[model samples]
Target: MVSVSRYGREMGSVFDLLGTHEPALTAALGWALGRSPELMSRFLNRLGLNGSSDVSDVAVQLETADEAGRTDIELFTSTAHVIIEAKQGWIVPGEVQLTAYAPRLDAAATSGLDTRLVTLSDSTAAWAHEVLPAEVSGVAVIHWSWDDVRDLIAEARSKVRGTERLWLDQLEDYMGAATSKRPVTDALAYCVVISNDLFGDATFRDYVVNQRVYFHPVTGGGWPTVPPNFLAFRWDNAVRQVNRVVDYEIVAHLSERFPSVADDHSAGSRPPGDAHVVYRLGPDIPLPDGGIPSGKQNLRAQRFWVLLDQLLTQPTVIEAREATKELGAT
Candidate 1:
């Protein structure tokens, strides 16, 4: 005999109810875009939409086709025609999907009008930007992640008041949860060390010594080295503050033996000079306000790690060009 379960009947979230229906999601987003100028500004900014224009004139869910293929959202002004294709979850919209909308955009384009294609998804739609036929469509393709939208809503929430503020607050909360649950690729884990005397320094200095000693170990053994991507901070004991923050690229990891200067340096019967891990760091890039506060250091790191990682991952476009020229010289 099978017993029927009766506990799973509750209605889920508003977004959950919307499910995979792109049209419905488009409508919900369009409504938000219609009401919030700040949201519209950010959305347009992500598409690389430039110059001074009336965001109030922006329209959404404009019917560019009647027979099953229509652009999801369109913002048309005197200067530009921006089309957005939005997707929910990890289900990516393919190039074929975008190409279908090209003819409509082509027909809509007028002389001197800047046409652009944009793909919005819960996760980074980098593939869409890569595959979309920008040359054929005669439009630039840009991808905006839901995280970008959340940031806009957060910005809007700060400046709005009364009913608008309340609605934006709710929307921001919803998007925050939605984006948080989306599966991330190359997700990073962070560990921060906060101490009154990280390097026994109370003031900013050019460099600091990090010492490591080992006991009952092989002669070749040494302290574990930090990754090139790791960050280190100096906390001041007297002021109960963080004096500096440094972003280091581990150029070299060197070790050598040092004679024991004090009894504390020795381990049991073993004399000093066991091992050392010298982390040669890169130049310092000081964060605002001297350094991140000890109380809020973790939060600050968590917030900026992604952006910092992207910077560290590759050289800038200008840098790349310079490197290419230097390579040719060799």
Candidate 2:
């Protein structure tokens, strides 16, 4: 039987297991996108990637080696010099490994270089950020605290929440005026909310953009119960949208409406199957049927007159200047 957890999106970090010494050290991560070894390693594992001899670690090697000893990293990058430092505990990476190793690595390379230090302790990390100078100890220092790491993770989700909320407000205004003329009491019909309008009809083009969209299973009732599906979008190909996280509140409401309507599509651009109605919310783009919907398509030019009139006549430059002056005086 298909399961519930099947709907979950994979959660990962840039760091993976660094070691038992500190939390950040042994984590998995994909890119040195300036994350700890542990976080970076975890990111890599989530995507199923790892070190191969074919890949270049110039960034890796130049930061790992010490001056006095011949290190594997220095030899591996095949450069004249290498400087990479790994440290743990209250020993202080900035004071000891990074500070000591950076110079040696810088000297080995005809080019300027520095090692990266990834550590576990929050206190040490705080010290690194507050005390460490920009280019000392032969390397450029980047430190991550437990608080920093937690905030980053929280920010990822928070961004989605913020975007969804903002767009929801815009969507309400958009649907009311954009398609209010249509008959909601009539048979079931769908509405597509967009962020920007990017479509044209032979001689004319219109763009009605909205950041959020409200989806409903059964379309017309006097102020129909708020639609269930909400997909937040970020542009990818300038044409396609990505990142569809189903909110728990949204999902809970949806479950109430569609007890059997839930079926998970594969992550990313995979098409939704067995879906009753589909609505996209993202940047402005042209729909297959042109920018105008069924009811208002023919009256678009006339409707444009209505919206345009509201914009031009509602307030003039004189009023704007008066308001501005009044505000400045206050």
Candidate 3:
């Protein structure tokens, strides 16, 4: 019951897998927070530690060990020392495990540094409220979900540009996908029409279409986070082929899916090593006659959905969409 994005990656895809792993999630969050002062500030503020200064030299460490065992993440700045205990899925941190880390915070406080212990899990903050004492060994406790971290990164993304923005974008998407936790449902009886002019390209016709596989990057354009059941391919002002989705996979690179023909530039320009979601489509269910035309309006590379039956009965794309909407209302 994996959830898949229609034009992009599916649930439990490579990206989501990377995110679900506790250590990877910790490393990613630590990396972004340490590099971006703005993001770090927002994070501290959310923990009720405001006006934090002299944080320019924040250092992040993972799996730091002491007599109390290893903490998941540790952040050391000029004015603050923070220890994070992160757990993935539905697991909750035990009170004994949390209390063991309290000594480190209290020790840091002796040096006149602001000290706190933060617990991160998939559960809501109420778990933190109930499990955590009023204070752990005199060190304040803070709770946060993966979603809170995602929102902070998203909010900070708008304020910066260039590489900073790029890092946040990757982190935000990863966290969002991981926290979605959507339960799988039955495939809908819907069709997504995709406009592609690659039919004129012989390599695409021979290798891609003939192979019945379609791949696209997860980023750089508009794509769904959840895949629909059917896909309709439109070209030369008409949609002639409608295929049911058989299976899909998310790969870190295109070569993983098509090694023999990876170098061929026929199926449009897909740079190697870029994350892509590839769909295995069923045999073409060709439309009748000259296929469904676009009528007077020009629909160029536009992705839209219509009821499956509308594609077989309607003569034009506009009429198909209108009829699909009408049926939906009834």
Candidate 4:
């Protein structure tokens, strides 16, 4: 009954009408994988199928029926043929279904193609790997979870641009919602870079230290669709204040909050009628002596999320960033 409004239309999604519908979700992923070679490569590599050649002229087939059963998705590249059996829940594909797909894979292998059968399910990778046989009828079987695909898309984002980037974003959003899997963005803390001019200004520091609120324009693509719980203020080569985000709202202008302050620039250059995201914060937690140093690494001006524990425990920003690589690895 729920839906995500995207591309200007309200349509059923995997979280709603298609929640347990295998073909629809399978087709959605197949479409994106067929279009983006980088995504395909990353996905195969994540499954430890690194020996397979890069995707070239890949084709995706959905619900192709044979005597045994209907396959959820079928992928073909010049050098390989991959059969995917997708399930919305943790259940493994029945022997009947596996038997249906194995021979087709064997025929492809006989034709001098790298044949593989992949199971995309809601179960943990460890469970699927343990129960599912490594090979079926001479073709390799790889187990993967929706969570794994979501993370792969997040990683592949850096390797793509333009339409490919947009496709990956949409795919990631859908998969995250469908599986009720919160992306890494939700697990981390958001860090904002305070400009030098504002960092040195007493009024700005006072408002943050005393008043305890931080805000930024909600117009940029840099902001996350879902906000994180903690916020860190970075300036003067260190993270000075780290606070829990109590609430956030969009306001029309600076005068709405600070009516008496004559300098409007303190709240930032608020274009008339523009909305900003104002984050209400709790008391700042004391950081280690000298605060968390930025060290030699140059962080971009845009806001980014960092593992909260890493940001607090690691001595330098670069080290904290390095620690974040281990996030979700387990």
Candidate 5:
């Protein structure tokens, strides 16, 4: 459940609504899929289907009723001809769970539909992202977590139907639980950092970013992200390891996940996998080039400078700085 203070006592906020009552979420999702179909069918009618006027819901299997298990939801996007396996819930029933579908999918495959799988759960999706066996090939898999789905649904519904109160309540409930609601860092940064830490290491944008991020969840409401291309993440801590330089080549690593941010925006700019800033504690070597110059600094760097001001306010870093500044400054 989300924080009570953010949502208020009136309604159980969005997070509370879903987190507290998952059955409702499942019901809503079923409704959403039933109406829209799990995979889009807009142009599916054109994608070479057998005797189709307008391709809609080529086939849907609510795995809950199937012998496989009740939690999984399978959808085939008629337009794309890809089977979207909405394998959600807590437990992921490995090889056996998927194999059960092989026969049904193979039969569908014979007709035309391309087979693909996308798992829509929190941790299971993350788990699938990492350990997707080599056997699972020629399939497109996307991981959309519970919170992400719920938020998107709430936002969309709130606007069209004027569920402002529901949306507001949800936002308030979530913020109440959130400890650091500062906009400095991106939304889901904490969740991502922690999830990757527990599961593995962070992928840092997971691809190059060239498109505008246009969505900052931390800012609350629906503020967009700092252009994914513009944002940077560099580590600074008490512990030292790998010269920090060893950690800089992550630019190219994110090409797949954020092609818009990775390819488009960075086209004429610096190549991928390069650090935007030098990230030094002091004005070391006076910044060889591309350094934060006296006045021609970017607004982002200025923001960094503001944080630098706060960093300076830290009693220890400042006390250390005071001792050293008198040594060099006029």
Candidate 6:
């Protein structure tokens, strides 16, 4: 009998083993999509398409022309036809690449069929959102991140059983691992500035002084190196008495940008660099009731050094945010 362990040893997954054979991945996705109507509905919803939960028919890698091109994954019914273009990793298809498939998609949308085009990526494609809508002639273009797909599968898992459920679980695990590996070089760190009347907001300054937290921004390039899922904080020049060195693992990467309304105390926007990654702070190190211990010596880097040393010994700190939560709950 064919077993997963035997195959997994040679390749990270059956999907990886298939490599550039888009047809195989298409077939796999098609099967999964058909089996889970909720998955199909959520997918269609992301593409801004209206569809019933019931999926009637699905096709894989349909070739429209020998050398021309093919649709990666096609879902069809009496009313709708969705042409999906999927990317595995960092490679993003340009408007020209997607434009090539427009003809095939248009031709398929006959007999009053509502046509939609979708591009799937492992991460958000800001450029695709900007370009694909205008470039693809007749069809409506939408983008879906791998995380969106994984969430759909996870939601559908509860409704499946037997080997189907096992397969869904495995696919979710594979996608999670693959997407997490995407490198994030630049991030916007949110910190608290504890200085006297810096921004002329006396009320805000009082709050910061009381809570012992202030809002500060740090760029990835400014630091020696930014380890993934970590927040590195720097104090403003005005703040002479505060921790000079401290960092915490980022928990939730919030969609909100830095220098937000609350950041009026901050000098300006994050320094020019790559895209600014935003995050919510993780758990802070246990502090005394008085906070950070009093005195000029308390501001030394050694204080933070000792805290980080202890944090590094914890396995949860090294893992992803979700995994860290699971460890804590146990």
Each prediction's number of clashing residue pairs: 0, 55, 7, 0, 27, 5
lDDT of 3 by residue, 289-315 (tens): 887887788777677677767767777
Residues 133-218, model 5: lDDT tens digits: 43343344444444455455455444443343444444434433221122233211110010111101223222211221211121
Tell me the alpha-carbon RMSD of every candidate. Answer: 19.5, 22.4, 17.8, 20.1, 14.7, 10.3
Q: Write the per-residue lDDT of candidate 2 for residues 252-329, one digit (tens) a residue.
A: 123233343235332221222221222334443222222222231222211011121121222422232234344331
lDDT of 2 at 139: 46
C-alpha local distance difference test of each model = 0.46, 0.29, 0.67, 0.69, 0.33, 0.47
Off by over 4 Å in 6: 1-28, 34-38, 45-52, 62-65, 89-91, 125-128, 180-330
**Candidate 3 ranges with C-alpha deviation above 4 Å:** 1-19, 183-330
| lDDT-better candidate, 2 vs 6 | 6
TM-score quality measure for candidate 1? 0.46
Cα RMSD of predicted structure 6:
10.3
Cα deviation at 125, candidate 4, in Å, is: 2.9
In angstroms, the error of model 5 at 138 is 6.6
lDDT of candidate 1 over 31-106, digit per residue (tens): 6777777777766776666652468676665446656487788777656777778766433356777767666667
In candidate 6, what are the lDDT values of residues 89-109, reduced to their tens digit?
Answer: 423456777787777666566
Deviation from native of the Cα of residue 65 in model 3, angstroms: 1.7
| Position 295, candidate 3: lDDT | 74
TM-score for each predicted model, relative to the true structure: 0.46, 0.25, 0.50, 0.49, 0.34, 0.50
Q: Is candidate 3 or candidate 4 better by TM-score?
A: 3
Q: Where is model 4 poorest over a 10-residue stretch in terms of lDDT?
A: 11-20
- Report the lDDT tens digits of candidate 4 across residue range 1-330: 565554443544433344425666787788788777889888766655576546776677888987877898887777778888987645556556676789888767888987878887655554466457888777777887777787788888988899888778777766754452444445477787765444223455565667788766545555643344788888787888898877765455544665543244443554523445567889878898778988787775656678888888888876887787656411
